[model samples]
Target: MVPEFFTQTNGRGDGEQTLAPDSSFSNLEEAEKALQELAQVFPQPHSFISGIGLDFATNEVSKAAVPPEAPLLNMEAKYRALVEQIPAVVFMAYLDQGIGEAYVSPQIETALGFSQSEWLEDPVRWYQQIHPDDKMRWSVEAAEMFLSGKPLRSSYRVMARDGRVLWFQCEAKMIRRADGSPWFIHGVGFDVTERKALEEAILEISAREQRRIAQDLHDGLGQHLTGIAFMSKVLEEKLSDKSLPEAEEAAKIVKMVNQAIENTRQLARGLHPVAAEPLGLFSALKKWASEVEGLFHIGCSFQCENPFPIHDVNLATHLYRIAQEAVNNAIRHGKSRNIVIGLSGKNGAGLLAIQDDGDGILKKQASQPGVGLSIMNYRADMVGGSLKVQANEGRGITVSCMFPIRSPE
Candidate 1:
């Protein structure tokens, strides 16, 4: 038997109405007649009872189609929530169309002290907010990333809404259209001001310590060794005047003491590079190359083309140390017989390169670099330059550092 139930319209816009049976139907014919009458009254596709026993085919009802906007609304809510919760500012900008930001995360306010609305109001605001000193470098890197469709990773400073300079490490990937054209850039900016400050502090401390050690070696150990060498020479001369065989051995002792003194001086120079400021980078490099050849018995040479002097002693020191490390690696590890150190300036930039003819770097070492290579790379970055070490085609390795020439303020 069909279950007895009553139906009423709730007026909730669902187009649903409930109805109750007027009388019990004994046969299918009577029930069909009643349903036909009810269908006319309702005038809509709906379920109806066919007889005392329900008929599955006749009682089944069709549901209304769900609106298309519901899923979109749900997805938009999820996206907004995700963007707001992220620590970095998430952004998407249209590249094919003019330079316009399509969407930015709510975290923009927390990152740069700028409201989401303010960022969206100005199309060129991103370019305008970069620190003036960093704009050119950032623009070049950004343009290259867009053109190459490569991921971008850069650290730069920006002027926040409150006029405070903040450093950000930005990472982005380019989105391409169906035709392989640049469409959009999706990226995140992480605040790195604290990390940058720490790095600067560490670098300063390292430089100061290096200077102290160099001073100790030059004034303390070097002076004592020089005094010993002089005393030994005097003893050697007195022994020679006495016509004794001991004079030869005393002379040898004097020579060894003098060599120790020279070695101490060389170590001091390598640590602090006092000659970098007085003799300039080119002259200092020439002296270093000659010393390397004399000490190691390797053919080391220095060459320069239109050599211009660098006024910044700190920058010169960093570059010189990088070269020194590269040359030492080539000689000690690569078993190089000959090395060439080259210096040149072009287009307001300086290039320092060291090439050695020896067994090139092994593939494993290149993948997992040692401390010396890492230190050289760190020095290059400290001087606002780039360092690249690669194996030559046939033999040997090349290390190059390129840095821009900035005028004194």
Candidate 2:
């Protein structure tokens, strides 16, 4: 020991140590004597050794000054908890360059038939499960939106882990870093297959009702009117007598009956005409052109290749009514000298074009209400079709409609 002393309030010598001439305590007796004297002087919490020197110091150890942090909950546990509570599938991933590792909720098993682990390590495994025919196009669109730094909302088809196809609506947002770089994205999706199916079912039911009504008008009411006409003719023949004044009255009644029959027949044709079939769409179009031209004395022309089949009764009825409305509008409002009707079909689609060389629709636009246009649009919508009304190049109005050939059923 070199020196030992206690610095207390009084500053008195509370301890003392002996320094050997050789600076070493090799003998057990000398070490024991020095240790016994050091013990009486050294303070509590302080230590002394026989062989150690005063210059020999222990290295300082430092502990971190940071406060303790709370333990983090496992991501899988947190994810499962969230998914069980929400109706949608919640997903998290790093998607800046492309989709990185991610976690899909366990709900994925029920919604998409994919296990949670299958989608975690490979985020794009979701895309691989998408319907093959739609994947390429859907991916292109999604990637385009992502690169443009826009959020994505889309509906796509996915093949479930159970080998079933399902539809989903995905809504996602990107997370940007402090420097405006994309870091990741979070998304939620829900199954929309049931909703879509319900909508389709409602449409089919509506179409079925429309067809039934059309048939009733064609078969039931039409036959009764025909019977009335025949009976009226028989009564006229049995009452043939120049001497009888009631014979002239009976003749008048028969004439009236014939007119009523003709009118009823026209009404039946308007309702659902059998002629619509034999002539096909173009034939019906020609018949319509002739009747309207004869009625209004406005020259009408019909042309176009039979680009579509006229087998669908509902479609034929829709096209016929659309044409009927167009012609009536042209005669009453269009005030055009010539009207042209064109019908064509190709590639599983049908087209109906009507153009009139009239005063155009400028006058109607300013003064008359556009109820006709609205009605046309509504009728087109009823059949899952589109209607376009525009001014002709020269001086007329053109109304065009394109309808899908397949029935909703």
Candidate 3:
């Protein structure tokens, strides 16, 4: 076998070596000549020859990439200096050829809970330290990018070596050799856990407020309004057959009482449902159309159909108010002779449209002289819904609203 040649540097930046052969060198002069030639070419003193091995034939040189002037020590000092000066922890890794088994930075001990030695021993240990819920998703995405030769960008959680859970946003890219094969991967990570917690807290508070308001509308004011409606009916019936000398006066009083009872029923409905069942939002629109027509001596027609159980009390209330307000506006301000209200829920959500044939908006009219439309807009926003109002074509006004049933989480 031919002997193998090895060389490294010693102190003073001078290249030197010790050579061993399977069988003692046949010619001492040739061995000395080969060693001197390698020393002249390298000539670095601080590098050390830590290992030397030889075959019995074919003398060839193969050495570890240990630089002269204490390479490992110099690299450590450079990294430590960087970590101290830079606000973020400094990291470096010796990435294996397969893009696995990277030498994670020593700063991991302070940034995360894991030690650098443990990660170097097993690169997958870092994956194990990731939060269980986010681990699979983040890992799969990272692997896809790495294997497909794309830059790696990801955010995930890590249970630190100190047992603290932290969120980190990481960015990395592959380092490839001249031939286009990946050589190593490098990346940086920083903590984003505090920002994430703050966002969650804000969402929790908003949801709690919405739930409380929904409960109040469904239980508190709704019950009281229902009682008033029943009592009004009782008074109307008792006054219906009265022994009064003025029969016409009695008749007019009874008529007004009946109207009051109807108005009170409408008010109670505005607060909450008396039917306890969904009352199907469209049915509420029809009731408004009838009331408006009778009260203002206008012709009003409504045709609507929809599914029940809207699930959101606030949304249902807002939708009903939008219809009521539109009809009232047509009667009081537009001086409408005829009105048409249409409600549809088949297009995946509730839709309300009201149109009236009347003298449309008076030009430059200030204050509009009605609270109905303003209240309608406010209620719509409270439920996270939308409303649209515009003058109808050729002498009329139209109001329309759409309510989204789903809540964004």
Give the whole-model CA lDDT for all candidates, comma-separated.
Answer: 0.78, 0.66, 0.61
**TM-scores of the models, in the given order?**
0.69, 0.49, 0.37
Write candidate 1's Cα lDDT for 346-366 as tens digits. 555677899999998888898
lDDT of 3 at 82: 72
lDDT of 1: 0.78
**RMSD to native, candidate 3:** 18.8
**Distance from true location, Cα of 6 in model 1, Å:** 36
Q: Which numbered prediction scores highest in TM-score against the true structure?
A: 1
Cand. 3 Cα-lDDT = 0.61
What is the C-alpha lDDT profile of model 2 across 39-152, one tens digit per residue? 555652134432222211232222222113311334555756767678888887875554346656778877876678767766568778876544544555467557877676
Candidates ranked by TM-score, best first? 1, 2, 3
lDDT of 3 by residue, 16-113 (tens): 54443334457967776654554455444114233232221334433433335556787877876676554443444544543244445566777875
Runs in model 1 lying further than 4 Å from the true structure: 1-69, 99-101, 111-113, 120-123, 161-163, 274-280, 292-314, 329-370, 383-409
Worst 10 residues of 2 by lDDT: 53-62
